[model samples]
Target: MVASIALPRLMRIGAGASRLLPEILGQLGLSRPFVVTDPYLVSSGRTDTLLERLASAGARGTIFSETVPDPTVASVEAALAALKAGDFDCVVGFGGGSPMDTAKAVAVLARHGGHMRDYKAPRLQDEPGLPIVAIPTTAGTGSEATRFTIVTDETSDEKMLCIGLAYLPVAALVDYELTLTKPKRLSADTGIDALTHAIEAYVSRKSNLFSDGLALQAMRLIAPNLRRVWTDPSDRAAREAMMLGATQAGIAFSNASVALVHGMSRPIGAHFHVAHGLSNAMLLPVVTAFSAPAAVARYAACARAM
Candidate 1:
C-alpha cells in the first residue's frame, strides 16, 4: 500500500516562531497580506505587535478582526469581502482555529467565488487558493498544520467541514510562547483535542505507515504533558511539547483522517455551541471504549504510546 501526505510548505517551530512571520512571508514571495484574526487578539495588542513587525520588515498588512468562534458562513463572506477590498497577495491567519478557518475559507472563496458550503466535505479543492500563512495562538486546533477547515452554516445551523490541499497553510508559525497565557480550561480542552486527533488517526481505517508514526509520536508528546501544562500554564517545557504534539497530531489526521469521535463531536458543537475541542474531549473516552474492542492491537499501541 502507498501512503500520501501533505503539509505546510514552510514551518517555523519554537520559542519565537511567530516573530519570523515577515521572513516567512518574504520566503513565500508574499508582501501584501490580508491578516485575519479575532477581536480578542486585536484588543490584546498581539495583532498590533504583529502588524508593526510586518511593517518593520516592509510587508504591508491589513487586518480583519471580526472572526468568531466556530466561524460562520456569513463571517467568511464578510472576510472575503474584506480580502477583495484590498490588493493583498496572500492571507495571514493569526490566532486560533476560528481565525485560521476564516482565512482558509476566504482564501478559497476569493479565488473560486462561491459560498462556504460549496467547499464542504467530500469536495476536493485541489487547486490552490491565495497563499496562507498561519500563526496559531493556541496549541490545540493544529489548524496551522492541517489541510482542513471548519465553518458553520448559519442558515442550516450545520458545521461545514471543508477539506483539501487548498485549506492547508503555505506556512505555519508554531510558537508555544503564544499559548503560555491560555487559561486552564482552554489548555485542558485543546490538549484533549490533540490527544484525540492522534488516537483517532492511529485507529482510523485510512491510517497508513507514515501517519502511524506521526500519530504515535504525537501521543507520546501530548499525553504526559497535557496535565503538566494544564496544572501550570506557564510551564514552558510542557507547553512546547503540547504545541509540537498538536501540530503532529494535525498532520497525522490530515493525512489519515479522524474517526468516530470527531464525526460525533461536530454536530454537538454546532447545536449546543460547545467549543470544538471541548466537544471532542467529551466524546473521546466513550468513543474509545466502544472502538477499542474492534481494534485491540491499534488501541493497545495507542495506550503504550501514551
Candidate 2:
C-alpha cells in the first residue's frame, strides 16, 4: 500500500546535535525565538546548557519555563502569553515532550487566536503556526519528530490529541548526550515507551513499508539497549542506541500511527497525572496481549525484530 510519511524538515541527530540549533535556525531563516521548557530543566541547568550553545553562535532567545508535566489548557495559555509578549520569530521547544507539546500548542494558539480545544482531533489544524525547532532532552516521546501534540483540558480532564501537519516541528535537534544523565526509572520508562511505539507502529492499521522498516529498526536498537541503559546509566553506547531508537520509533508512529496502547494510556495519564511514557509502559503488556491475536504476523515480526 502507498504510505504517507511526514517528518521534520531538518533533523540534526548526533551526540551533541542540539549545539547546532543556531545553524538550524539560520537555515530556516528564523533569528529571534522563544524557548518553551519546564522549570525542572531550568533548575537542573539543562536549559542553560542549550542557551549557552545558542549564545555561542550569537543567537539568544527568551525562555518560557512554565510548561507542566501534562500540559493543560491553562499552561498553553500561559505559554501563549509569554509568546505574545515577545517579538520572537520562532518557537524553540527545548526539553522533553511536555515542553515540546506546549510549544506546539502555544505556537498554534498564538497564531490562530483560539483555545487549544478548537484544534483537537476531529478538527485538523493544518494551518501553519510559528516555526518550531524541537530539542528533546529525553529519548522518549519523540515529540521532536512527530506531527502530533497532546494537551489536557483542565475542565474536562480529557487529554486532547491534536493532530495535523501544522503541529510538526520545522526542525529537530536530537542530542543523545542530553539523556546520558537520566536516572534509571526515567530511562526504563522512556525506553519502554519507545519500544511500544515501534511495536504499535509496525502493527497499526496504517502501517506501510516505510513505517515497517523504521519500526523494526527502532525495535532492534531499543530491545537490547533498554536494560543496558537502566542498569548502567553511564553507558554511552546504550544511551545513544536508546536515543536513536526513540527518535526512529517517533518517526515510525508519526507516519503510521499508534493504536490501542496509546489510546488507553492517554486517558490514564490525564486522570492520574502519570508521566506519558510511564503510562504507556503501564499499558503496553496488557494492551499488546489483547491486540496480538488480530495481528499475529505483525506482532511476530516485531518480536523477531527485537
Candidate 3:
C-alpha cells in the first residue's frame, strides 16, 4: 500500500525556543498574524509577551483568546468572524492542543469561507489556508507538527476528525522551556497522550516503514522521560526529551493514523468534557487489554516498554 507523510515546513527545537518566534515569522515572510490561544495564556500574560515579540519583529496581530478546550463549531465561527474583521496574513497557535487545534480550524474555515463540517474526513481539504505557526506549551498532543485536527461539532455534539494536507503547519516552534510551568496533572495527561500516540501509531493498520521508525523512537523517548518529568518537574533535560518525543509521536500518528483509542477518546471528550489526553489515559489499560487479544505482540511490547 502507498503511504503519505506531512509536517511543518520549518521547526525550531530547543530551550528558549519561543523567543525565536519573531525571527521565525520573518523568515517565513508572515506579518500581522492573528494569535489564537486560550484565556489562561492571556490572563497569565504570555499573550502580552507574544504581542511584544510580534511588535519587536515589526509584525502586527489581533489576539483571539476565546478558544475553548473542546472548541465547538460555534467557537470556530466566532473566530472566523473575528478573522474576517481583521487583516491577518497568518495565524499563530500558542498553548496546548485545544488552542492549537482551534488555530488550525480557524485557519481553514475562516480562509475557505465554509463551515467546519465542509472539511470533514473522507474528504481531503486540498487548500492550504493561511500559513500557521504553532508554539506548543504542552509536551503532548504534538499539534505543533501534524496535519490533523480533532474538532467538535456543536450540531451533532461529535468530535469531527479532520484529516488531510490542510491541517499541517507551515512552521512549528517547539521549546521545552515553555513546559517549565506545566502543572503535574497536565504533564501526566500529556505524557500519556504522547504515549498513546506512539503506541497506536505502531499498531495502526496503516502503519508503514516511515511511521514505524518515528513510532519506535517516540516510544523509546517518551516511555522513560514521561515518568521522569512527572516525578521531577524541574528536570530540564527530561522535559526537553518528553517534548521531542511528543513531537515525534505526533509525526508518527499523523503519517500512520491512530486507531481505537482515538476513535473512542474523541467521543468521551465531546460528551464528558474530559481533556483528550486524560480521556486517552483513562482508556489506555482497558483498551490495551481488549486489543491485546488481536495484536498481542504489539500490546506486549508496549506493556513491557511501559
Please, what is the TM-score per model? 0.98, 0.97, 0.95
Top model number, lDDT: 1
The segments of candidate 2 whose C-alpha lies over 4 angstroms from its true place after superposition are none
Which residue window of length 10 is worst by lDDT in model 3? 297-306
Sorted on lDDT, best first, the list reads: 1, 2, 3
lDDT of each: 0.93, 0.89, 0.88
Number of colliding residue pairs in each model? 0, 0, 0
Model 3, 177-229: lDDT tens per residue? 88988899999999999999999998888898898888888888888888889
lDDT of 2 by residue, 101-122 (tens): 9999888887889788888898
Better of 1 and 2 by lDDT: 1
Give me the displacement of residue 140 in model 3, in angstroms: 1.0
TM-score of 2: 0.97
**Clashes, model 3:** 0
